[model samples]
Target: MSSNPESSSRVDPSIVPLMRSLALELVIYGPIVTIYFFLVLHRTNNWLTNIFNASSTEYAIVAVLLIGGQGVMLEMFTSWLLRRIGLRH
Candidate 1:
């Protein structure tokens, strides 16, 4: 019922960035999943025992460090992938 057609047909600019982030997340999580299977799942008792042996503070610190390391690795991987794909110089 409105004469302004462009207003009704306006596109969202944030969707592209959101999608790119999702794709990057998928790529980033691949290594974490692989590591989980190879290290944690394969040696469930050993890993669980190690966790149980550590103090709460020590466990929290290690968990944070591992997550931070994963993020750093993800960034490196994303950069490498982008360069290989010729998207980044």
Candidate 2:
């Protein structure tokens, strides 16, 4: 049998304020995150070009690194921003 809805990841209706705060944070950070990633990638564009010509194995490795690296950096940024603004998650 399936677990109760409260245990699910879906947003709970009782925490509208929390949801609003998160939505507000995303609105503020979306552009910043996108630009930061773009600038970081732009600075190492020669590395990017090399990757495009890489073998499949190398491409897989680079893909994992890029995704994981960006995810960690963005998560850290979001955590710092939220904490700085006194939002607790």
> Which candidate gets the maximum lDDT versus the true structure?
2
Candidate 1 at residue 29, lDDT?
Answer: 60
- In angstroms, give how far residue 53 of model 2 lies from its true place: 1.3
Residue 72 C-alpha lDDT in model 2: 94
CA lDDT, every model vs. true structure: 0.69, 0.80
Clashes of 2: 0
TM-score of 1: 0.46
Model 1, 1-89: lDDT tens digits are 55888786976666666676657666766886788668855776676568768777777887788679878976887667665644323
What's each prediction's TM-score? Answer: 0.46, 0.62
Output the lDDT of residue 16, model 1: 64
Report backbone clashes per prediction: 0, 0
**Cα lDDT tens digits for candidate 2, 1-89:** 77887767775455766787798799889898678768887777788678778777787888899889878988888888888878666
